[model samples]
Target: MMLRVTDQTMTMSAQRSLAASQARLAAAQAAASSGQRIGRPSDDPVGAGESLRVRAQIAAASQHQRNIDDGTAWLTTLDSALGSATGFLRQVRDLAVQGGNGSLNQNGRDALATQIDSLRKDLLGAANTRYLGRNIFAGSSDAPAAFTDGAPPTYSGTPGDTVQRRISPEQTVRVDGDGAAVFGTGADSVFGILDAISADLRNGVDPTGRLQALDAAMNRVVAGRVDAGARLSGLQRAGTENMTERNALEQRRSGIEDLDLGKAVLDLQVQQTNYQAALAITAKVLQPSLTDFLR
Candidate 1:
């Protein structure tokens, strides 16, 4: 069978070829300018889904880092207060030792008692410390302070549970310390210990036994500080891990979402050359049409 060749069919074919060349040129130029591979979901469906997932992971990791920062601050504030409390307790122990000496007369003992009393108040102040206007040792309680003033300071903080912060998918940190555990609950607490020493000195009673009580209170404060240090270490470790993971996710997303500028530029040049060639061919082929001869 012989196929008939027609001028109209040739013209239509040339127009279609030119349109395709122009479309390729436009796409290449867009890729060069935007610097992203996934302009639309249809560009690369699998790559687009992966990019979205990685971006969401990055956002979640960022939030985790923020939680770690906040938790670190809370622990730091609590630790500072505990350090001061430890110092005050040590001073109280020294005073108790001086008061315990038999050579010290009642009048001398009274002066030591006064200083111990002052230090006890300072210790109480440290126990009732707040970070960001919330009691750090009060667990979930919204109380301003953990302890109330009294002969034996009372724990007004309802330490229901340890306060926790989420630093990552698999990790959570305890940000609050147990107040009743560190300082004692009521009149039987460290404040009570100091008050007993004061009363004994005024009543001509020897305060030597009170030295042991001071030692016990100092131990509690020291232990609390140790716990805070451990928590701080964990927070730092989690922060480092989060940063590492976030970097990896960003790199993976860049592979899926960002353009290879070198390749895009080369492609754009090739497409431009092809489009120009197509335009030249279309002009040469259409120049000898019947309409041109009539003109």
Candidate 2:
């Protein structure tokens, strides 16, 4: 029997269809096994673009959240160092009050004067607080102290070049407190007040007059600490907000980009079944060719 032209074309068309279906089945099986929607842009251009967008958003939000966390940590360090400095200043003020009493003999006052001197040195040392190898209170200067060593405490750092670190898109906070603003006043520096108080107590001069000035210096330090503490509180709040926001963004991104495990497993089972079925059908279709069909 002679085959018609239409029958020959039909056989070739069916074979191509089976081959194409087999290829699709194999790709679907591979996709299910790997648990990804798009292995290549040609596989699913629309889905691939969406996944890329979600991934980019996730990366950006994660980095922003990290920045907020890092900034909060740095601010926390500043608050701690300021707390320590405040304690040192208050200690010196307490010494001033105790030494002001005239009832103590020269020996007692002399010894009290010595303690006061040591406390002053401690206060100055405390002013040189550093974090990450950079001065926390020394503004731009990394000097041992914010004050001059000789006689009066001199202001060391400039104001304009103060360091400010970016904590967020719209926010930048000062990383280092201005040393001059923190310590030295216009007329007399913190060191000057401490020195004058120490000298007055040692000479049996009018020590009562120094009490007001010493307390003022202590108050200044405490007030500055409170301000820094407030700023730190703001940063902590910002970090928390950023964490929550970033988590939400990541959740959305995951929904858009991450594979659904349950669906992927089910799809894998279906694709595997289909792939096996296709191979069996293809074997039958390609086996014995037109000779088998006649049989």
Candidate 3:
């Protein structure tokens, strides 16, 4: 059976074919220009889903890297403060020993007492050290100073919680140290020890008790430095790991989301050629009017 062909049918068919060709060309051009294989979910559902997941992972890794940077700064500042505290404690300990010497006269002991008094204030200053307007030793307390002035300096800041920073999906690190634990409050503290030593020197009394206290305080400072040093080292290691993971994620995301310009351009050229050929064919195959049919 022969199927009768009509001008209207031919024209309609040509239009549909042209529209489809144009759609293909548009899609190829979009891929070429946007630099992405997956523009919309409809393009390739599975590919688009994979791209979304990879992009999300990239973003998360980038955020974790930022957290690691911030954590590094916090730990650096805290460690520096602890270092200063260690120096101050050591200096005061030496002065206490000199004051305890039997041959030292009252006036000599008084001079040593003056130096020790100055060292105590310096230690207090170290105790109340602030970084970015926040006390380094004050834990999470945002107080300006960690210690207050007195015979035994008072710790006004709370025993704040340790600040932890996320460096990866599965890892977090302690960025802030406990201040109350390092420099104890009031009479039993480093400051208190210094006070007793100064008072004993002025009164011509031996500084044996003060010397013992000073040794214990110095040990505490040493322990604090050790802990801070360990944390700093861990932060360094975490930072290195984060960088490695970030690079890996970037490569993965690029494989899924990034466009292959060379291939896209070739595809675009082929699509353009096909569309042009369709136009030429449609002009010849579709009749413009019934005049052509009668001829």
Candidate 4:
């Protein structure tokens, strides 16, 4: 009876040891297959919390990258509008130079005047540039056109309307530019000068001062175009910087979040070897049963 009782105790101890070994092997297998130690909070609460924080950071960085791209696209639209506007102003300037020649008879001047009118209409259309259903030059009004049709193209919006674009954490850049500065105001406006010239031409009046006014308007437009170009350059620089930083951050985040395939494969192989050894040991230990002892 004493010998049988001792044997039973030994068997139970061996069974418990084998069960622990099997549990460890299962854990190693799961870790190798999943490639993550903490599947849930129940697996490792502290590690899960860290993973959540890292993931949130990565998401925020990705969103910031998208913001940078959107800002750049908007700036590109603005640049395109400015380029077209520059060309329109150049047409007006050419007309001004042509009209300045006194050798032109009344009929010649009238023809040139008509050409200027066509170009002015084109300029007005250009001023109302829109991208994605939003007016780029309307000073945040979202108006269909920056200027309304009349004797002189009149502004229907306020001045100095601006918008901010966030390029980075704690860093914001201004994207919107005031329309009045570029278009001119009151008597000095391109539309105003063009209107005066058109009226003088209709009255059969010599538009000597009107030609000079066009020259002045041309200068303003050129200067404004240059300013717009500078702003676009700045936008490009800022966008490039933001992209570089964001990409670097993404790389860093990947280092933390993404599995190292080389290291992971090595670890998996090691775990497989360890698990197989444990299995072999367990199989040997588990071979003895009550039936074997009875036999």
Runs in model 2 with CA error above 4 Å? 1-15, 42-47, 140-148, 185-187, 289-295
lDDT of prediction 1: 0.87
Over 1-295, each residue of candidate 2 has an lDDT whose tens digit, in order, gives 9966664575687677667767766776676667666678887688678778877766765666676666566567767766776776677777767777767777777777788788778777667666777666667776655565667656566665566656566777765676666776444767788788778778876566877877777677777777777877777777787677778877765665557778777766776677677668756755555765785
Taking all chains together, each candidate's TM-score versus the true structure is 0.91, 0.83, 0.92, 0.80
User: With candidate 2 superimposed using the best TM-score fit, by how many Å does residue 13's alpha carbon deviate from the native?
Assistant: 4.0
lDDT of each: 0.87, 0.70, 0.83, 0.69
Candidate 3 lDDT by residue in tens digits, 1-295? 9999887788888899999999999999989899988888887898888878888887998898888888888878878878888887777777778888899999999999899888888888878877677777777776667888887988876665766789888888877766677777667888888888889999999887767777888888778878878988987888798788879978887897778999999999999999999999998887476686776
What local lDDT score does residue 159 receive in model 4, on the 0 to 100 scale? 80
| Candidate 4 per-residue lDDT over residues 15-108, each given as its tens digit | 7766776676566556666766564577767656766776776677667667667666766777676677778767766666666676777787
The backbone clash count of each candidate, in order, is: 0, 1, 0, 0
Instruction: Report each candidate's C-alpha RMSD, comma-separated, in the order given.
Output: 2.4, 3.8, 2.4, 3.8
Top candidate on lDDT is 1
Report RMSD for candidate 4.
3.8
Top candidate when judged by TM-score against the true structure: 3
Name the better of 1 and 3 by lDDT: 1
Candidate 1 residue 17 C-alpha distance from true site, Å? 2.8
- Evaluated at residue 110, the lDDT of candidate 3 is 92
